[model samples]
Target: MVSLSDYLILSSIIFCIGLAGIFINRTNIITLLMCVELILVAVNTNFIAFSHFLGNEAGQIFVFFILTVAAAEVAIGLAILTLLFRVRGSIDVDVTNSLKG
Candidate 1:
């Protein structure tokens, strides 16, 4: 049977992978955004695991709120990235440092 430690270990592994993706894909905005989503998923996994173990609904409720916020964040980030791409012709992180419009 799966235990809390197992769940936590999986969550940590996922979180680490997300962190590594974000750091390794330094020049790709889309990949970085995806990595952020991965990290959020890892967090939600922890919340769900703890909620189940503790017999409380609070963690699930918090996870719901987190999902809502994450959805909004992705939408906004995509929109901004689209606009930036249109203006700059590429979504290079280095180019954004001197963004002028």
Candidate 2:
């Protein structure tokens, strides 16, 4: 039988992997976005696990809202990335500095 600690540990591991990915790969915007999504997923996993173990729906509800926000964020991020690529011809994060006025 899996315990709450087990779930927490799993969530932490996932979160760490996502964090590491973000730090190690700073060249591509797509990889950064994916790492961010992975972090969100890790958070969602923790919410679901705690909600189930505690017999409360609040965590689950929070996860739902988090997912909704994540979806919107991804949409907006992709749109901006598309425009950046169209203008700069590259999706490199370092190139984004030129956008600063």
Candidate 3:
């Protein structure tokens, strides 16, 4: 039987992987966005696991909202990425830093 601690450990592992991906691969905006999504997935997993174990619907509801927000974020992020690619011809993070002016 799986316990809450097991779920927590799984979530933490996923979170760490996502965090590491972001830090280790700073060259591509797409990779960064993917890592952020992975982190969100980890959070959602925790919410679902806790909600199931505690017999409460609140965590599930929060996951629903988090998913909704995540979707919107993806849409906007992709749009920005598209524009950046169109203008700069490259999606490298360092290339974006030159747009400050």
Candidate 4:
């Protein structure tokens, strides 16, 4: 039987890895978005794990909602990134500081 602690640990580890990637790579919007997705996935994994362990359907339903929002976030974020790349001719997040008013 998979324990709740085990699932939480796994999810935490995955989330940390994604965070590390986001911090280490200061540029590349696509990579950043991918890492964000990874973190979101990790969160969803935890939700599912807890739902299963506690025998509650609420967590699973929350996970579905999270997934739906993540999908929308990715879609919009990518579209913006695409537009930025087209205008700036680069996808470096570090260069975003130049957008200051």
Candidate 5:
């Protein structure tokens, strides 16, 4: 049986790792996207774990919504990144900041 505390701890660790990635990698848009995905995955893990622990379906339902939002976020984010790359000729967010039409 999976312990709720262990699940929560794992979620926390994953979230921290994602945060670190975001802070440490400030160049590539792809790396930022990956970090965001990791954070979302951590949230999903917590939601499912809590749902199971509390014997409630609401948490799982919320997780579904979160997943949907994450997907939408990634799609829109990637589209924007593509546009940025097209305009700047590079995928580095730091360099893309100087680009203006």
Candidate 6:
């Protein structure tokens, strides 16, 4: 039987991995977006685990809200990235140092 601590530890590990990916993959915008999703997944894992352990529905409800928000966030982020790519022909973060119109 898995305990709450076990779930939390797993969540922590996943969260750290997401953070590392975001920090290390500094070149590609798509990869950064994926890392952000990964971080959200880690948060969802914690929410579900806590909901199960506490025998409450609030956590699950919050998880659904997070999921919806995350989806919208991804969509908007991709759209912006698409526009940036079309305008600049690249999604490299270093290129954004100069805001040219």
Q: Which lDDT tens digits does candidate 2 get at residues 41-92? A: 9999999999999999999999999999999999999999999899899999
Per-residue lDDT over 1-101 for candidate 6, one digit per residue giving the tens place of the 0 to 100 score = 99999999999998999999988886888989998988999999999999999999999999999999999999999999999999999999886779576
Candidate 1 vs candidate 6, lDDT winner: 1
Taken over the whole model, the C-alpha lDDT of each candidate is 0.94, 0.93, 0.95, 0.90, 0.91, 0.93
lDDT of 3 at 4: 94
Candidate 5 residue 38 C-alpha distance from true site, Å: 0.7
Q: Tens digits of per-residue lDDT for model 3 on 1-101?
A: 99999999999999999999999996899999999998999999999999999999999999999999999999999999999899999999889675465
2-41: candidate 4 lDDT, tens digit per residue: 7889999999999998999999988687888888998998
Tens-digit lDDT track for model 1 on 23-89? 8886889989999999999999999999999999999999999999999999999999999999899
The clash count of every prediction, one per candidate, is 0, 0, 0, 0, 0, 0
Off by over 4 Å in 6: 99-101
Error of 5 at 12 (Å): 0.6
Lowest lDDT 10-residue stretch of candidate 4: 92-101
Ranking by lDDT: 3, 1, 2, 6, 5, 4
What's the lDDT of the predicted structure labeled candidate 6? Answer: 0.93
Please identify model 4 stretches exceeding 4 Å from their true place: none
- Tell me the lDDT of candidate 4: 0.90
Looking at model 2, which ten-residue stretch has the lowest summed lDDT? 92-101
